[model samples]
Target: MGQQEWMTKDFYAILGVDKSADAQAIKKAYRKLARTYHPDHNAQNPQAEERFKEIGEAYAVLSDAEKRRQYDAIRAMAGGGARFSAGPGGPGGSGSFDDVFASMFGGATGRGGAGFGNGSFRFTSPGGSGGFEDVMSGLFGAGSRGGFGGFGQQPQRGGDLTSSTRLSFRQAIEGATLKLRVEGREMTVRVPAGVRDGQQLRLRGKGRQVPGGQPGDLLLTVEVAPHPVYSRSGEADLIADIPISIGEAVAGGSVEVPLLDGSSARIKIPAGTSSGMKLRLKGKGVRSSGKRRAGDLYARVRIVVPRKPSRDVTDAARRIDEAADFDPREGLTTQAGW
Candidate 1:
């Protein structure tokens, strides 16, 4: 931002903080304003967007010890005893830091050169190298990028910030509003439904803000916790292992399976169904979240045998097995060309 801007804009007032506010106080104030004016939270208010930007800019400058020092120094140098102005002369223009710097370096050396004289600020380039703005950029961190590089534009957009969160498997599939701590401050972020684990959610205008540029985004990484009874498959299907009694598997029957949505779905087990057989319930897995389509639920059947059999039951089982003459794996080797 221009010196005029830093000189005029009351950053402390904008942030509703005292000039002597401590680092913690400044941070607390900024976070409160950031949450209040966050674009997503106040989308309907154009003024809030602008206010949010202002709050960020103030925070960015004040939060950094070095930048804060420079800012205070600049303002101090511009106050009483001396006045700042363009086109040298006196009070209104001369006798200021600019005039002192010019005098220090014999005559107005034009832009683009190397270090000059004894130990007087070891800069790579002899700074008087460009427009007046370039000179300003060198003294104060503004107008140019890479700071002392050269004078051209205002500060670039604020840097992007990163944060992470843990979500329940169900929460990952269903949209949720999350409160997260970012850069040691608390802010609210939205997690869209159907968000896969390891995916990132970008919260716009929710990052650091440059003095005179666009605010950056907050990149949120999501992690879904594992579920004991259910798991997510590559096809977005929800899976579960269902154990059924031998009788239920041998004769077609209905089995109630748990769903990710905390509900139960009844699936039919075909007659003579074997262990490891899979049953599917279309559109019964994870419900649609955002643009994701509904997913299916797959249940793998596991047949449980009776731990102990009565003499009569054992005899009846042997008779039934003898009558059925079926061996599911009998032709496995022949099919493999054994």
Candidate 2:
């Protein structure tokens, strides 16, 4: 907003707050009003959207400490039956805003080339040095020369454009290239391998471009969809539960395990392997980059019990139990020390 706007608009009244309101109180009031008027919540009401924007502008000015101070000072000075103008009948006749400023701060103003000293105030503009134009430009914005870009600094880059996209679990893991439309133009983005859900990727120089300045970046957030059969651990580790029968586990045979690459691996089950035992397949998980180590695939064994058995099988099990005569829970009491 222009610096002159502060002399007219009462930001405190716009925000429905007091001049002495604390920062947190002002913020809370702004949030409450903003939510009530937000277009997302009140889409059918067009006035609500406009009111939301007004509230945002009011907050933006009042939230900054320096801007708030300047606004208050300007309001106190040029408010109530008084204004600074150039023509006759101007405050005290023929005085300008610069004259009001010169009186406020310790300075001298006259037709004798207007020398400024005894106070720290200087306005450096082409063809005009100590005038209202330079002062306003320093407070508000530089017209074309980009004066201070807000108090005499050079121009700054524009803001980043934020967007989000959804990716399948496999696409997130294996890495894929994507094409998206932004600002009426298509841009290519690369999703790296082993990227976790809710990860953010920044596309440099792909956002809003400032006039006579560098462009901003594009912050692309990713949401990975879930997979039913495969799960992840740490950076790139793949975890899967391999279900096996009690017979297969006891006999120690080779079993087929599915991989993320649309292929299956034959895993040899060691003899005496029990349920919940984990076996690692090296370099079968996610890819590594830079100083990161490659991930491994962890397969956990889960023994499945038969829901029902035939009478012949029951008879055979009884004969085998009698022949073995081994107690699996023999050391339970000793281990528990009960």
Candidate 3:
């Protein structure tokens, strides 16, 4: 095992947990710490978000069994009998393992192996060394090896920054662009058409600056505001309750209903349409970029009763009840309690 700063960071300590913590325990600790240090929750404190990021990175590694093993191994090796000996009268004299570890991993010479900077550790092996590169490659593949610090060699894209955005139900369904204020800069980002609540939208190359590398992305987590009259059922569907008068319910008529886009459409109410009857309007709901087709809007019919009934209305109802020969609950009774 090779010693690395990341290994010595003690992610478990940062999250305030023991190495024996289970997945659920790790997750709970991470969430608690994340909430405590979250940028939104700790606006005035500059270190809160950074600590939160640390917690996230810690959880990202510790949550996985293999990663946790590697991390533990690196920490053990870093703190073990690997004291820094002046590399045959090198620059620094005999020092603690920290100095040697730092000199070797700090990219001071960039001679290969792994280098640590920009809050992360990079492994660039010079062909040989029983380091993480070999273990990671054997366990995963070339793609996975890229994660350890080799492969693509292309400058890595900056990490995606996350923030939350609140959208009205209509806007979530109709799709809208949001102006996000991140790091004191306002950036206009497109919220894809038919985005759902809690859905994440990735805007590539919109994150923090990386030395000699392209900027990262901005990841927006959307929170859709509840609407008084409308609700979302899925990625591309809108649901609403439509009220119909007694006459309209019995006789059938075209009634206007509001769509998600703030537009109204006339839907034909069939004769004898009962309360709770659902009607679907094709292509009147949310629109998805991939499908390029609008989802159907569902309208549930709810019969509206008159607040004040006139004598004529009462008499007509009485006459209709008296004229009806069929009992609505005829089959509900059991024969002799059998």
Candidate 4:
């Protein structure tokens, strides 16, 4: 952006935030406004599209600490409403604003260089060594080279875009490629394996395009649907709750557990296995893209007991309980004491 344009535009006002607003507050305001004015949400509305662009520009400047500071200084120095005239000293011409910068930097007041027409004037140093961008580079850091038409104006990068896609749990774990339409263009996106729900993927140079600057990126958020029998845990682990009878928990045996790929695995339950115990199956979880090993599967035990028992069954249970003589909650009082 040009210094002159920056002086005229109220970035804070555009974002509906105070000049003293913190970085988070500024970001919050920008997101809200961007969503409201986004082109996808406001088809055929030129005003909204323009507003969205303005909001993006404001955010791009305000989000960076150094850029915000420099912008504030410039606005304050130029009184927030200064305009650059098209010519040398005269009424409605290059005045105090131009003269102050020129005298301070020893820059000559002229026009037509840096591709600016006779109708527009620029504050440039002698022999085109420095212009507004050059001066800014000297003061802060280096600015955009050339000019607006000829390296005087900074290249305004296109705004980043956000979109989302839905995936089944299987697809999320195994990976899939799907097509998504963004900004009226259909793009094929690769949903990486082991991607968690609500994970965001950034696609560079896949956003709105501007004439003379770098294109923005696309922020794609993935939403994975829930599975009926399976769930996930840390990194790439898979979890499944397996139900076993009281006899199985006490004696223990092999049980058939369902796998994600329409198969089953025989898991051996150790003798006297208790409820809530987990069995780990190596190399049975979600697979990563390449080289990295797949994760493991955890089967949690849930012991089920009969709700209603016949007289004979109750008698047998009483005889077994007497023979075992085990107190399951023996240390409950002391262990749970505060």
Candidate 5:
């Protein structure tokens, strides 16, 4: 919305929240009211739909830290919900809103200068600097010399945009070219390999088009999906569980392990290897980057025993257990008074 419209709105009151409400409290109020008056929940009810829109508009402005500050400033300047008119005596006859701005920006007074005409007003300071558009650009965070177009409640300057995309686990490890819908337009983006979850990327000059100045940037966030077989750790290290038979753990030897590249590699399993032992395979994880070296893959050992063994196998196990005479939990109840 434009500056003029913003001055007339009571966003705090619309959301049924006090001016001192915190972000969390404001969010809670918005969610509760949105659920109650949403169009999906109250179909064919115009009043409910309008209420839902108002709630959304209020949240859109209040949820943003910068937008909320600007809105609050404008509301305060207008004496808390003041209506702007073409003539003098704004809101409760304090003075014309234009006159207030003219005095602040050092613009000329009376009609034909910072005055209203044809349902619109203009504020032009000396040397074309410190005008209403310049003040608005600063408030809206548009860069220097990047004032908004059509200051008389017209189209605004382009602002930075934000978006997020989801990537599969493999795609996160291996870079992929994706086409994403941003600002209602499909654009191609290249995601680097080994991108961690919640990483943000910035693209310059890819935001909304402005009338005169350069376009703003697009901030993209990446979300990596979980992998069923493998997971990541540290900067680029990968982890996986490798199941080995009990016999292999007892008499360890060379075994083939799976890799993310649809291949397998043989690694030696030390004799007398136990369950939960980790074996590191160098250069088997993520690719090398300028900032980070190539990572290693950790294979955690899991000893698997036979289920429902045959009679002969059961007899052999019983004999072996008797010969070993081993107590796995030797501490028993003496430890920790358990």
Candidate 6:
């Protein structure tokens, strides 16, 4: 949808739910409205189709957790609803809504009246006509003005802080807590289990101080270190290599395998299991918060040959070769055009 719709639509009202509704509640409302007003379901009613599209657009923004938060913040800044400027020849000057607002609230009377900075607005005083109080009261209304005193009295949320955290391969898979040092303060943060590398963690009310407002959050970007023996695929699966002796490969047995959680588990190897064989251990891999089911761990077998053999072993090998008379390269010459 266009920017105007974003500023005008009350998504919570359209979905028939409160602003405090959780993600599931929002989803349920959207689905119900969407199905009832679907284009196919109301082919003869153009209004139903339009309403369906509007509901879909609203749901698209409000259903997502992150996007919903941002939308709510913007809406709050607009005082529950946004203000639009009349078109050309309207009461205000000929310009965009933002431009008109800037002209009216953009001077020292407002803050320094300079203009908008970053994501905030600043106001300045007029030439030499009136005092700070007079100009501020005139611009921002009597209850709250825009001067040093007024600004100091206003409640403004603290600025958000950003940081980076690094975790070991196993920690990334199993999750970990980190002690972070931000702005000369030490804080402990819990990194959710199964967090992937490069994911961001947000800690609420953990930022710079604000005059009369609550503190903002701290945003941490996670970096996962590589493992010596294991590799990750997607968010859950793990791959590793397992070495087996020649005797074990032929005889089959149970072996102790290291897990990502720093523990060990017994893995069974079937008799006559060959080199390059793969074994899967269920529910032993990474866990994901988004999905219900856990992933599996895959181990690839590598058979190791002995560098030296005893006389009896050599003799037994020779006898076995003679008895089998096997030719592993029998078709290589023909295939290679030798």
C-alpha local distance difference test of each model: 0.66, 0.67, 0.65, 0.72, 0.68, 0.64
RMSD of 6: 18.4
Q: How many clashing pairs does model 5 include?
A: 0
Off by over 4 Å in 2: 1-145, 149-156, 182-185, 291-293, 306-338
TM-scores for the candidates: 0.52, 0.53, 0.59, 0.58, 0.60, 0.50
What RMSD value applies to candidate 2?
Answer: 11.1
Q: State the lDDT of candidate 6 residue by residue for 101-121, as single tens digits.
A: 354445312222323343333
Query: What's the residue-level lDDT of 14 in candidate 2?
Result: 90
Q: Which structure among the candidates has the greatest lDDT?
A: 4
**Backbone steric clashes in candidate 1, count:** 3
Q: Which stretches of candidate 1 lie over 4 Å from their true place?
A: 1-155, 306-317, 335-337
lDDT of 5 by residue, 52-171 (tens): 666666776787777787677677666743334333322223454445455544663333233344333433434552444454554465643432223333334566655556789889
Q: Give the TM-score of candidate 2.
A: 0.53
- Ten residues in a row with the worst lDDT in model 4? 140-149
Best-to-worst order by lDDT is 4, 5, 2, 1, 3, 6
**Which is the better candidate, 3 or 4, if ranked by lDDT?**
4
Which candidate would rank higher by TM-score, 1 or 4?
4
Which has the better lDDT: candidate 3, or candidate 5? Answer: 5
**Residues 23-92, model 2: lDDT tens digits:** 8788777766765775657879988866765676677667667657767766766654443333221223
> Relative to the unseen true structure, what is the C-alpha lDDT of residue 323 in candidate 1, on a scale of 0 to 100?
80
Candidate 3 per-residue lDDT over residues 1-338, each given as its tens digit: 11234645888898899989998798677666765776877889988877866666676567667768756755664566543222321343233333434544453432233333433333433553335433333332222223343443434334445566678877777678778777677888888777876555667877766577667666665667788888877767778899999779877999999865557989999998889898999888777777868788899899998799999988876786687555766756575464
How many Å off is the CA of 212 in candidate 2? 4.1
lDDT of candidate 5 vs native?
0.68
lDDT of 4: 0.72
Tens-place lDDT digits, model 4, residues 1-338: 34446667999999999999998798778767766887768998989877876776687677768768767867776774544443443433344345444544466443333333543344454354444555454344333443433444555556566665668999999999998887578878787798887566767887767777777777666668899778998887899899998678878899999998899998999989988899999999988777378999999988987889889878877887898899988999899994
